[model samples]
Target: MGLKWTDSLEIALDLIEEHPDVDPKQLHFPQLMQWVIALERFDDDPKHCGERILEAIQLCWMDEAD
Candidate 1:
């Protein structure tokens, strides 16, 4: 199944894979949201996203990064 807004960890993993050099902690929410939407397997309405969701994804990404 394609990824939804709730799939924060999966999305974080994918983001790291797709942009290995990026620092997840430094990403702005708008850019992060765009990148998430650009993920090949992502499948969700952009309207479903919010600051909290973005923060969750960022936290997951940071955890994976560390």
Candidate 2:
């Protein structure tokens, strides 16, 4: 019911596909992980429909070389 690492990757891939302007090189992994954690937390909160977490969430794009 929440976003795991795999889920986050899927979301990230979709976002990268949608936004041509997005640069994967500029992403920071630490910040991205924190956001993912927050997203999962929001999903578990019954009172919150996870709207706040959904607002402007960014996922990092990982290259195969890395």
Candidate 3:
């Protein structure tokens, strides 16, 4: 199975690898969603993403960044 909307940690890890220089703390949901959708392993419906899911992804990314 590929990455889904619920795969916050996995997505975050991919984001860290894909955008090592990006500051997750400064990203907006739209941009975050866009990047997630563009990830190589991402395989979810963009329409399924919501504010809470995006927040979770961002938080995971920030946590891993530290």
Candidate 4:
């Protein structure tokens, strides 16, 4: 299952708060950048941050359905 939207948003914000140097907008273009984005996007929504990152990574995967 996909992560809750609030969870995603929280992670994104945490990356922003902790690093304070990484740019969030650049994340959509690169794999590493995307990881950073995911971290920032789900850093404060409960305690499933790790799960949120995994879900985000899977979202980029190309499946047989596609």
Candidate 2 regions off by >4 Å? 13-22, 40-66
What tens digits encode model 4's per-residue C-alpha lDDT throughout 1-66?
Answer: 334444434444444456455444344434533454455333334343354554453343212113
RMSD of each: 0.4, 8.6, 0.5, 9.8
Least well predicted 10-residue stretch by lDDT in candidate 4: 57-66
Candidate 3 per-residue lDDT, tens place, 1-66, comes to 899999999999999999999999999999999999999999999999999999999999999999
Q: How many backbone clashes are present in model 4? A: 10
lDDT of 1 by residue, 1-66 (tens): 899999999999999999999998789999999999999999999999999999999999999999
Q: What lDDT does the true structure give each of the candidates?
A: 0.97, 0.44, 0.98, 0.42
TM-score quality measure for candidate 3? 0.98
lDDT tens readout by residue for model 2, 1-66: 554443445556555555546565564545544444454232333333243333334423444113
TM-scores across all candidates? 0.98, 0.36, 0.98, 0.32
Off by over 4 Å in 3: none
Give the winner by lDDT: 3 or 4. 3
